[model samples]
Target: METTIALYSHDSVGLGHARRNRALAYALAEHLPDRLGGSVRGLLIAGHPDAGRDPLPDGWDWLILPGLTRGPGGTVPRRLGGDAEDLRALRAATARAALTALRPDLLIVDRHPFGIDGEFLPALRDLRAQGCAIVLGLREVLDAPEPAALEWERLGGAEHVADHLDAVWVYGDAQVYDPRLTGELPGALAHLATTTGYLGHGRPPAPRGERRPAGDGGPRAPYLLTVLGGGSDGAELARVAAAAEPPAGHHHLLVTGPQMAEEDIAEVRSIARPGTSVVRSAADVPELIAEASAVVSMAGYNTLAELLVTSTPALVVPRTRRRQEQPRRARALAALGAVTTQGIDTLTPAVVTDWWRQAVATRCDRTGIDLGGLAVVPRLAAELLGHGASTGRATTGHAASGRRAAGRRTASRQEVRAVAV
Candidate 1:
C-alpha cells in the first residue's frame, strides 16, 4: 500500500506557513516508509508565489494556488493580476481539484482550520467522507486568548476544528506557551492538541567552536546580521539598524527580504555607512545566522526556529500592530531566557547602539527543550494514521534502527536549508 500526504499552507503575506509546511513535507517523505510499511508521497498545496524556491524531496510535489491575501477588514486577492472574485474561485477550484486527484491518506492544514473565507471547507468535507485523516498545525502562540477566542468564534473556527480535524500539532513546547491557555482550542478539540516542541533547522553550518566571539585583542568587528522576515513592516528596523553604530569592529549585512519595496531599500541604503551592506535575501538564512555575532529581527516562527537550533544571540523587536502573535511569542521566548525583546517605539538608533555595545550572548536555555520536532512530527503523523505508537518523541525503542536508516537517507539528500521565500 502507498500513502499520500497533502499539506495546505494558505499563506497570504509572509513565508512562515509555506516554509514550515515544506519542512514537515520533507520529514514525512523520509519517515513514512518506516511507519506505514509502504511507499509514501508528499504534496504541498500553497498560495505563496515563492513556494517554488524551496527544495523538495524525491517523492515530494507541490501545487501553487492563486495567491490570496487578507486585508485589514476583509479578504483580498494578491498577485492574481486579475479579478479578485475570479482568482478566489480559481484558488478554491485548484485546491478541490488537488484533493480529488491525490486522494491523500492524511491532510494537514496550517494555521487556519477553515482557511481564509472558508476556502477549504468543501475539500475538508470531501476528505472526511473519504476517510482521510485531517490535522491542524499551529504555531506556539496566536494572538491573546480573549481576542483569539472572539475571532475563532466569529469565523466558525471551533466547529471546523472539531468536526473536520483529527488532531492538532503545535510547533512549540507547552511550558513556553500553551494554545489551551489562549482559548484558541475549543473544549471539544482539546484532546487533539499536542505540543511537538520547536521545529529545528538541523545543524547550523558554523562549527560550534567557531560560534564563540574572537578571544584576542579586545572586541574585533563583530558581524551583525539584520533580518525582518518578510520585510514589509521591517523598514524602520532596517533603517535604524543601518544608521546605528555597530559594535567596535562589527560590520553589518541587512537582508530586508524579498517583499521589501524599492523605496524601503533605498531608505535603508541612504544612511548605510561604507561598511554596511543590504541584500534582499540570503541563499541560506541559517548559514548566514551562524556566521553572525548576533541577529536583529522580528519574532516570526521560522526565524525563531533557526535561532534555537543555531543557538545564536538575537535581539527581537516584534511586530505587534494588528496581530499580537509576534510580540506574544517574543515575550514567551524572553521568559525562557532564549532571546531579548525590545519595543519598536524604543528601537531608536541610539537604543540599538547602546544594546549592541553590551549585548553579548542571549541564547536561550535549551536544556530538556524539544528541538527535535522535525523528527517528532513524523512520529505523530504515523500515530494519527493508526500504524504506529503515539509517543511524543520519535520512536527510539524498536524503531531506532528505522530512524537511523532514515537519517542516512536524509543525509544523502540535499542539505536541509531554510529559505525565506
Candidate 2:
C-alpha cells in the first residue's frame, strides 16, 4: 500500500526549519515512487500562516494554522490580538479538523512536537490512536540538554513527544555529538532514536556555459562571498563583512538571507563599496561558491555541508547568541581542517579582514573532508520506508545501541590512505 507522510513543521519565525523539512518532504516523495511499489504523498502542516505561501513541490499539500511567532529566548510567543484561551480553543479546533481530514499513515513532526502553540496535542493523540507512525525530525542541535529538558517539560512537550512518537530521526552524525547532549529524549522514546547521519539538502548541478569569466573584466580577483544562513541574526556579520575594505586585488559579494529586515538590507547596501555587491537572496549560491576564490559565512549546517562538498576555501563566522549549535558545528569543521573559524566574540571588521586575508593566502587541501552527505538522502528515504538496507553495517548489530555502522564508504581519498596505512 502507498504511504502518506504528513509533515508538521511549526516554523513560525525562521526559514531554516521549514526549508529543511521541505527538502525532506521532497526527498521522500521523489524517492518513494521508484523504491516502493506504491507512491508517497506529503502534506505539510504549517504553524505560520504566511509559510504556506512559499513555493512547494507539486505532490505536496499544505494546511495553514493560526500563526505563531518566536518570542524572547527562542520561546513560542503566545497568541496575540485575541483572548489567550479563545485563541487556544480556536487553534485546537482547527488542528483537530485538519488532522481528521488528512489522516496520514505517518506523522513527521519537524523540530517540535506540540506544534509551537501546544495546539496540536489533541490532534497528535488522535492520530496516534489511529496507529499512524509518529516521527520527530530533529536537527542535530537544540542548544543545551538540561535547559531544553526543563523548558520542554514546562511546556508539556517532552511527555507528548515521548508518549506518541514512534521514531526520532536526528539529521546528524552521532559521532560528532550525541543528540542527548542537546535535548532530553525521554526513556520511552529512547529505543526509537535513529541517527540518520546528515540529511543535507542537495543543490542542482552547475549550469552549462555558466563559467565565471576571467580578468578585471573577467571574474574579479580574490573576491570574498559573505553570506548569513537566513539573515535573521546576521546584521552584525553583514556590517562587518561589508565594512571591511578588501585588498587591492579583491572584491566582495554580500548575500543577505531572505529573513533579514529591510532596514538591515539597506544598512548593508549603504556600506557596500565600489567593488561590492549586496544582494538579498540568490538561487545561485552554490555557483557563487564554486567560482569564488573564498567564502565567509555563518556555520549553518546546510552551509557548512555545501562548503564541504565544494571544498571551497572558506571561513566560518558562527552565530553564538541564538543557539550554540553553529559554534559547535564550526569548531568541529575547523578541527577537521575543513574550514577556518572566526570566533563569535572576536568577529570585528578588522578581525574579519585579517581572517579574509589569511584565508585567501592559506592553501589547505580540503580534499580530505567528505562531500558524500547528499548521496545519503536517497538511502535515508529507502531506510525510512523499510525497503532497502543501508550500505553500512551496525558496529554492534543492534539498532538500539548508539554505535555507528561499520564498513561505511568514505568520501575522501585521505580516508582510503588511513585505511590503507
Candidate 3:
C-alpha cells in the first residue's frame, strides 16, 4: 500500500510556518521515491495569506484554509467578508473536508498541538481514533523559557503533545537551544522528541521564464538584501535602513513582506535613496539570497535557516519588545559565529551601515551547524511510520489545567527541550 502523509500548517503572523512546511513537503516528494521504492502521496493543509503565491510541487497539493492573524491578545479569522460566526463555521467545515479526503496514514502538524483556535482538534481526534501516527514539529526557538512554559500550559499544548502525539521533531540542533531545558518541556513528552537540525533553503525554485530582477525590466543586480519577515511590525527597521547611507557601489533591495501596511510601504519608498528598491514580496528567496552581497533581517527561524544554508553573512536585528524568541536566537547565532547581532534599542543609520559593511566583507563558515534537516525531517517522518527506528511511546494523557499542583497561574514560556551544554 502507498504511504500517505498529511501536513497541517496553522500560520497566523507570518509566512514562516507555511514556508517551512512547503519545504518539508517538497523534500518528502523528492525523497520518498528513493526511500519507499514505489509510490507515495502528500497533502498539505495550509492557511498562509501568501499560500496562493508559491509554485506547488509534483505528487503533492495544498488545501488553502481561511487565513487568520495574531496579536498581543490572540488569533482571529481573516479574509471572510461576512459574519465572523459564519466564517468560523466555514473554516471548521473546510478543515474537516480536507482531512477526511486525505485520510492519511501519518499526520504531521506544525507548531501548535491543538492548532490555532483548536480547529485541528476534530480532525486530530478522527485520525487518532484510526490509529494514525501523528507528529508535532517545532522550531529551534519559540520564546524565552518562562513565558513559553506559561503559554504552553495555558494553551494546553504540552498536555496535547503528551496525549495525542506519536513524536516531536525539533528542527534545530540541541547545542543551539534544547527545548526540554529552556522551554521546560514536560519529561513525558520530551522522551518522544528528536532534534532534526534546521531545514535548508534547497535549490531556489526556477523562475517562470522572462522574470526581471528587483529593478525595472532587467535581471536583478547583485545587492544587499533586507527582509523584515511579514513586515507587520518592521516599519521602523525598514525606514531606518532605507534612509541609511550605503557603501559606494552597493545597491539595496528591501523586501517588506506581504503583511506590511500600504502606508508603511509608501513611507519606506519615499525615504529610499537612489539605487535602493522597495518590494512587497519575493517568490524565490534562495535566488535572492544568492544574488545578495549580504543580508539584514530579523532572526526568525525560517530566515535564519536560509541565511545559514546560503552562507550569507547577515546582520540580524531581532525583535524584542513583545517577544524574546528573535533576540535569544540572534544571541545564539552570534555566539556560534553564524551571524552578527544588533539591538534595536541602539540602532541608527550609521550603525546599520557599519554592520552592512562588515557583513559584506565576511564569509560565514557553516561547518559547525546542521542544514541537513531538509533530508532529516523526511527520514523522521518515515521512522514515525515504522520504517526506521520505532517512535517512542506517546500514549495520550489528560489535558493540563495550565497550572502546577498549586492553583496559581504560571509565568513565561521556554523553547529549549534540554539544557544546552
Which candidate would rank higher by lDDT, 1 or 3? 1
9-113 per-residue lDDT for model 1 (tens digits): 888878888888988887787777888899999799888878766667778887888788777656677865766667777888889988887777788999887
Better of 1 and 3 by TM-score: 3
lDDT tens per residue, model 3, 63-148? 88887765455566676555545655676688878877666767888887776667778888877765576788888777878887
What TM-score, over all chains together, does every model reach?
A: 0.86, 0.80, 0.87
lDDT against the true structure, per candidate, is: 0.76, 0.66, 0.73
Candidate 3, residue 260: lDDT: 91
On TM-score, the candidate that comes out on top is: 3
Reference-based lDDT, residue 369, model 2: 44
| Model 1 ranges off by over 4 Å | 201-222, 360-365, 392-421
Clash count, one per candidate: 4, 2, 27
Model 2 lDDT at residue 36: 60
**Cα misplacement distance, residue 172 of candidate 3 (Å):** 0.6
Count: clashes, candidate 3: 27
